[model samples]
Target chain A: MKQLFVLDDKKRTSPIKVLLNVLLVCILLVAVFWLSLSAINVTFDFSFLGNFQVRIWQGFLMTVFLSLASLILSLIVGVLSAVGQNSKILFFRYLCNIYVGFIRGTPLIMQIYLFFYIVGTAWGIENRFIAGVIILSVFEGAYIAEIIRGSLLSIDDSQLEAAKAVGFTKMQTTRYVILPQLVARTLPALTGQFASIIKDSSLLSMIAVIELTQTMREISATTFKLFECYLFLGILYLCLTLPISFISKRLEGAFNYEN
Target chain B: MKIEFYGLVKQFDDDRVILKSIDFCDDIHTLAIIGPSGGGKSTLLRIIGGLILPTAGEIYVDGEKVSADENELQKYRKNIGYVFQQGGLFRHMTAIENITVPLIKVHGYSKEQAEERAGELLGRFGLLEEGHKRPAALSGGQQQRVAIARAIAAKPKMLLLDEPTSALDPEYTTEVLDIIHELKQQGIDFIIVTHEMGFARHACDKVAFLCDGQLMEYGESSRLFNQPETEQFRTFLGKLLEWNV
Candidate 1:
């Protein structure tokens, strides 16, 4: 038993042992959930999946489209706000600061309603999908800006001085010294934020956006199969985000320099 | 280089005076400012490099007043090179790129011209093979040498090195000092803040000893090292050389 736990100098565990342990842990997780699910009065029925296939597929596609569109828009907003937060002009700095502060201080669900009902209505944005994407983009943009700003602040003052000493103009310094370092440090966090954007878009179901969650909600309401719908919903989300988290982990390692 | 300072003062946060009033002048091809740490040596060097603005003072370098305006400062900085305690090389860029990028971007050299000049400097500094490596991959001495090469690649009017070898081992320190000696022989003007007393005494023409926010002594390096003045400087030299072979 002791030898089984002990590793050789290389510290490499046997592949067979690792695989077996992983399988056992997965089996244990499923068993626990199955035991609870069996004890509950609710019956598990995925038969409705076949009946509502088209609606669910469309909802999943909507979620993907919303997350993808918001990801790109949020990233643009993030880079601008992050750089703006460090701007010499007070107006740019304060605007970025207040945006980040307000979005972070309040809840996202409140922001979704307020933006869709008040701001979106005021702006004549009648399409629920467009309003939902805009709201999600605005919300995620603030968090992304904070992530970028944190990495920006972590850059050494010496780097700036070195650039100045070499006579790099402000624009050139941003292009050469600041941007490369910024990309290297912030890429992983930004990728992780995309995962958050996917999860957060589910809340747009509240506004009747017809996304995956809304489709599932509608289906469950009619079928009275809440648990089955939600359980399958989680599996579908994992299918999207599990690969993202894996990529995020790989990116974190890829950017790791010894310095 | 004829350099003059009139009532130079630098304070941080209005309360901490890193440099009390400083008035000094010197005309030397190679100058070294040496003293204990936290003695305003690096701060004085930074003001000379136009990287920092003194709170109250006027500086004249080679009969030209170093102004605090942004445009004038950028122009002034354009003709000078500065090396910080760390190499301050872009960590993401390879050592050669560290030298070439600045030359191409800031100095307006073509990419080929920049690469040629960077290659020459790397070879001169014995970093030709290490040129492909980033600062993190290079050794401390290599990083500092790359910094020195980067600083001199544009052939600046003056080079300001703030303890370039402070982070290196004794072996690497000797190597960096040797490069400075070669630069001195080549007759490129420089101002260095260093703790290596022997290099200060031998390699440099003029020496300024700063301690406790004041310039206590300034003279020819040979004469000053041989015959010291000021009780503070005398004690400092004694303590420093006491451990020497």
Candidate 2:
């Protein structure tokens, strides 16, 4: 009975393997740090971070707000655009196609600039954060649309037929059957797109948005510690992104029906 | 319930005719549609279930004409229970959830009521233990049982089965056939498109033979199988017998 609980060799992680993996990662990290410090001749001190902690924290909060807002807006845009692309109406399908094509073809930075300088100005939108959110949402919405469309297409035609056979209206079929499956199928892609959104929030610095990158740039300029400032910025971005990646992975596993 | 198809014509691109002008009306509790591959057997079933629209035709279920408009079709479809050959149970839903969805969503049963009904159906179908398992986790036979349970959950006027046991092995096919037989005894009307000749002969009251998108012959199962009126049906039966042997 005791033997029944013993893990098979394939399932077990040997202590030696675990120790070696940890050792390798430590060595690699140390080597990179030493190399960077030696090459730049910068002191390995993060003391300057304390002075700008509040500013950095504020910027971090803004970044989170921007990402979450853009993510929600983009998801709405994505689902609508995907549905438009899939619509039986020729005009709607073509319109969605043009939107997806134009966004995907142009550079995201260029789009942001265009939106801020021209569209926002024309619309009398003065707030930089709102403008940034709009730009990011539009940019990410196109890619998310494609992701959603691909996921929706991946569902078998029989599923739709089955729903119809059971007397589910087109709307009911989409809401109850297609949407649930689509959420599961697109969760990983959606997560990746969200992480991209967080990283892209850094681009708002160009438009004078007081996000993490902009704050770090200000700190570096005042202190003349570019490398250290950039390193902390990188760590800050990781702090924002790593949790999203981890949680989404857990969600992906939980939603996985294929297994 | 009586089902009637009047001058049913299905054509694509003004050239390929899947079904030519056909008129059929029958009062059948269990009708078996048997035909060669590429015949309009599945298409006919789909048309009846409102999954496909006929180019020129009228469908009457229980003497009420089924309209072509989407909303009207949906209302008409509510009275139908269609089962596909592949046992099209939602892969993400458990067997019980598959049955409960129509009950809760379409029929407006409360969650608890739907679950209770689902449990009763699962128990009736010998799938009580498999209720929590998703379609992927269930055997082919079990999935088909769940599909049947889901179809009949709404208590539709009639059930349409398209090759319900085609994907199952002999043992599983027998299991499904047994369930179908039991359902028939319960006074449920069924229109089945099937390749299982033995089950069709034994279970169905009427048999319709289709070939090249045309209904060649249709009559009582005893007369159609034992003393076929058409040469096409005779040849088809000979081939089926040879293959079975």
Candidate 3:
């Protein structure tokens, strides 16, 4: 089977070799941190983490929930938008193009601010969590739409012709022929997008969403352990993102249809 | 079943004509359309199968006029089976699933019924053991056989083939032609667009010669092959015959 990760293993690193390299890096990092602490005359203490552990855990849970909800909404929006973009009707195609253009061209932070300050205010929505999800979904949805459109278009034209020639209705063709192939082709990209979504959830801190980053900010301010709080936040993000990356790699391997 | 094409004209960008004012009718069970490359043979077949809309033309299948409406076209298409130059089998589906999908999904056959029918078709094509293999895993010949099996699974009134064996090696070509011949013996109507002049002569009841987006000749296979009237057809057949030799 072809390897999915595309990493060249011609210069194969042995397990012991990799372990030694990791240990060397870890030692170097530790040395640098120790020197920095000494230079600042600050004692490195992680005891402050325990004081705000529950609050941080709550924030972590909130981030996960927000990401999950936004992921689902974004996928729905992406699919609908992709279909709209690829629609035979000129107006629908242009409409989707403009939407993807506007969302993608603007900064995510700006879009979030616009949604929170303008759209949310106009709609009289006071729930910050809901607003955060909406913002993330719309922002991520644009990227997902482009990913889906690219993936769908990448499929050979003959596939659709075959489906139609086989007497499948347009919807049936999409449901049976297009969607299955589309899902397989788009999954790796979707997983990458999902990891981005999880990391970008940190941006919700600006809106007082009390997510992981927000919690880290509060902890750092109260306990005066900015470095430790930020480090923990970075580790938390890796915890969220690495599994998605690993699973997507595995899925790419499994769905390697060509091979 | 009878099929007719009246004043069929397919043009692109208002000037590039692919098929120009083709008027032909045939009631034969197997009609072979032979032409040079880019001669509009496949385009005519596609137009006849309702896969492509003619820029200007009317098609009648078994006395029923084909329409542009999606529902009507789908209904019309259900009665016709089309096999592409490439097998065009779904890459994700196994041969059995490829054959059975339309049976279960379009014809509303029960899963068991669809599978049984698929098994029977695969068995008939000497591909029973290969049913679980996807298109990429199958040989070129095996893929074409599965494609034909899938096309015929619904027992369509007419089968349209667009250069069905064009992509195959000689061995696979012979294999596919043999299957097509067998299917014809079973009284399945076919309109095959092919470069296989020998097969067209031997297997087809009628033959149409198209060139430069025009129907040069249309008549019984024996007459058209033996005594082609037009200079263009003679030149086309001369090249084909020289190539075959």
Candidate 4:
């Protein structure tokens, strides 16, 4: 007989075990949260939710809009940069490298402040919402480019050699072979990146863009309900991200057969 | 086919020369390049196929110079088929699509024309029933056959086989080799890099023995195998053939 602690394929999961584990986890989380709340001598009051309902909904919509816009623009930027890194022109290749390096190396908060105040001002980008979308796209595009470029690089050299051997032009190879692979390999990560873009858009609050966090910030500042506002803000963001994360996971499972 | 090289060289680094001062002018059909591991056989074949450029020198097939420029090389590569050891079929494509995509995209065949040609080749290779399957779904031997079908889909002037059966077992190796022999019988001229000494001796018209980045011997296959010129090649043959049953 195998030891009790050993993992065995024959030892299948049971419904009761699953239910018990989930219940225990929920109880542990609530117990810890309750103990912390009592220790801090904090009493929650969510009555201000009635007054700021409209503003909160508007903020949520703005966050959604900002995320959607950023996701698309960043996807374009990501694909271009990923392809650029493989360019024959040294200038184009280095430009992609430096762009990805600068964005990934720096903190997002610093990027928001720098791009919004300095670069946006210099470029005469006066609209905060547009500036926020552009800033978020630029920030997230670097990470997406890395995700795409990694998949691009992981494609075997032999695949390319075979394409060349068959007389494919650069454009034809990209169309027939490389693009299909890039899509199959990067779809899950790109969907997951949408969730990250939504979360990252919250940083635009620093520049007074009325995304979810900014609206919550104003309400909490006025009503003196900081904990309640932030807690509700987290829940609101989760509502937006949870479905996207679930889709990303499903895509990951679906694409596992390509290998 | 006549393969002529003028001072051919390939260097990956300052000192890491893969092919060093290769000088050969040969007029032969059905050539096989046999060499020790890492002896630059595949690199030489790739250079000839225009898949890669040599550091310095030129390859002349039928007295026509193969350009080293990436853009110009495409014109040369289109006329030559290359089979890699791993089959190198596009992982996402079915066996038939692997053949047809190149025909339609590179050769400008209509979809019907490409598919018809691909179906004929797959049938000839005895893969008609399996043509709809992806490369991953096929066995190693089947994948290599699909790769071969993909290679010759557009009727390349000459085919380059780079250790095409190295990854297969004895049975699958025979299946791939049998198809290759049938291709030769159909007058599809080819140059192969292989370790099958018996196949190289019996099937090929010319044999070039490469070792340590140099062509150690080159001659008619039967004569060279029986009477290798270099002392090094003789010792090499002894070690290779000693345990053969």
Residues A1-259, model 3: lDDT tens digits: 2242234569675676667668888999999989998999877678878878799999999999999999999999999999999899999999999999999999888888888999899999899999999899999999999999999889899999998888899999989988899889999999999999998888999899999999999989988888888888899999999999999999998877765
Q: Candidate 4, B151: how far from true, in Å?
A: 1.1
- Residue A93 accuracy (lDDT) in model 1: 98
Candidate 4 per-residue lDDT, tens place, B1-245, comes to: 88899999999867789899999997777999998898999989989989878999878989999887788899888898989999489988999899888888888999999999989988988999998888888989999999999888888889899999989999899999999999989999999999999889988999999998999999999999989899879988999988988
List ranges where model 2 is wrong by over 4 Å. Answer: A1-9, A12-16, A88-91
CAPRI grade, predicted model 1: medium
Q: After superposition, how far is residue A247 of candidate 3 from its true place, in Å?
A: 1.4
lDDT for model 1, please. 0.91
How well is each residue in B121-196 modelled by candidate 2, as lDDT tens digits? 8999999999998998888899999999999998989999999999998889988999999999999999999998
Top candidate (lDDT): 1
Model 3 segments more than 4 A misplaced: A1-43, A87-95, B243-245
Best by DockQ: 2
Candidate 4's error at B196, in angstroms? 0.8
Worst 10 residues of 4 chain B by lDDT: B11-20
- The TM-score of candidate 1 is 0.92
* iRMS values for every prediction: 1.5, 1.2, 1.1, 1.5
List DockQ, one per candidate, in order. Answer: 0.67, 0.71, 0.67, 0.63
Q: Model 4: per-residue lDDT, tens digit, A134-190?
A: 999999999999999999988888788788888889998888888888888899999
TM-score of each: 0.92, 0.93, 0.90, 0.88
- Separately for all candidates shown, the number of backbone clashes (residues 3 or more apart, or on different chains) is 0, 0, 0, 0
Question: For all the candidates, what are their Cα RMSDs to the real structure?
Answer: 2.6, 3.4, 3.6, 3.3
Model 4 C-alpha RMSD vs. true structure (Å) is 3.3
> On a 0 to 100 scale, what is the lDDT of residue A148 in model 3?
96
